[model samples]
Target: MSEVYDRLRGEIVDGTFETGAQLVELALAERYGTSRTPVREALRRLEQDGLVERGDRGMRVRTRSPEEILEIYEVRISLEATAASAAAQRHSEFDLIRIRRAQAAMDSTSTDDPAAMAAANRAVHEAIWVASHNGTIVDLLTRLNNHLTRYPATTLKVQGRWAEALDEHRALIDAIEQRDAARAHDLARDHMTKARDLRLQIYREDPTA
Candidate 1:
């Protein structure tokens, strides 16, 4: 049952399950070669995570509006900036090495595939969050980022933006490496601000965003 829940949660976050779609318990059970019990339990957990919703009809995936996307980004900017600041103040040499590894992965994959870029982007931020040494911050970031995965990769898929995004990340890493908490905070904030604006633009272009 826990395994079922984990699998379903991963599919939902990675866009395999998608948003605004019905999650029929029996169907899911058959699809996963499991019984209805685990499927129902998984749906319950997904609902708690805000990844799914329940109504008189049944369970369905949650949908986000353009406004909701913007709000999520705004919240991310604030939280991630604080995390970056904390990471800068607390990070050790080992943390720096881990972050550099993630950054290198991002640099390599950002230009290749949307899925890889998304994974690498997540890794980089998670590394930073680990450096913060605040479990609360890490948990919040995990939840927020899980929600963020619902959005399309179109913003990051922009033609010239990948390189620019890598550069911004490099700048952020430089600040963190220097142990400049204020600079790391500001850079992370600005990075997310631009990402928010870009995503907003993407949503505007696609009303279904």
Candidate 2:
């Protein structure tokens, strides 16, 4: 059940299923080479996770409104700041290396490749969340992040956002490494705020978004 759920959830989050794509239990079962029972169970779990929604069109991958996206980011700002602050005070040397290595990977990836950039960017942020060593904060951020993926376009695709975001990530890592909790907190808040702004801008420009 867990394996089926995880696989289905991954597909939705990664855009394999796509936003607003109808999810039929029979089709999913056949695609996953499983019985309809497990597929049905996975769909139920996805609905609970807010990844699947029931509408006039029936069950489909959820699509978020701009307002919903902004609201999620507002909560994200507070939570991300908390995580960065805690990370600055508590992260081990290994944690610091993890964060840096993630950034290094992002740097090595071509900015022209938005998909690679976004994945690398997530790696950097996720590393910091893990470095925070706060279970509750990490869990909350992870869930919030899944919601953000509902809109599949990456904010890094915005003109000039990729380089700017990379620099911000570097500064954030430096603050964390220096054990500057206040600076780390402020940097995290600013990073997410800019990201939210860019996301809305991109969304507004896309009629289908």
> Which candidate has the top score in TM-score?
1
Model 2: per-residue lDDT, tens digit, 65-159?
88887889999999999999999999999999899899999999987777788899999999999999999998899888877767778988788
Would you list the C-alpha lDDT of every candidate in the order shown?
0.85, 0.88
Clash pairs detected, candidate 1: none
Candidate 1 per-residue lDDT, tens place, 1-209, comes to 99999988888876687677789999999989999999999998778676888766899888878878877878889989999999999999999999999999887783657777877888998999999999998988788776766775656787787788889889999999999999999999998898888888877787554
Name the runs in model 2 displaced over 4 angstroms: 1-7, 10-18, 56-58, 207-209
- Supply candidate 2's per-residue lDDT for 101: 94
Evaluate model 1: give its TM-score: 0.90
Q: Per-prediction TM-score, please? A: 0.90, 0.88
Where does the lowest 10-residue lDDT sum fall in candidate 1? 146-155
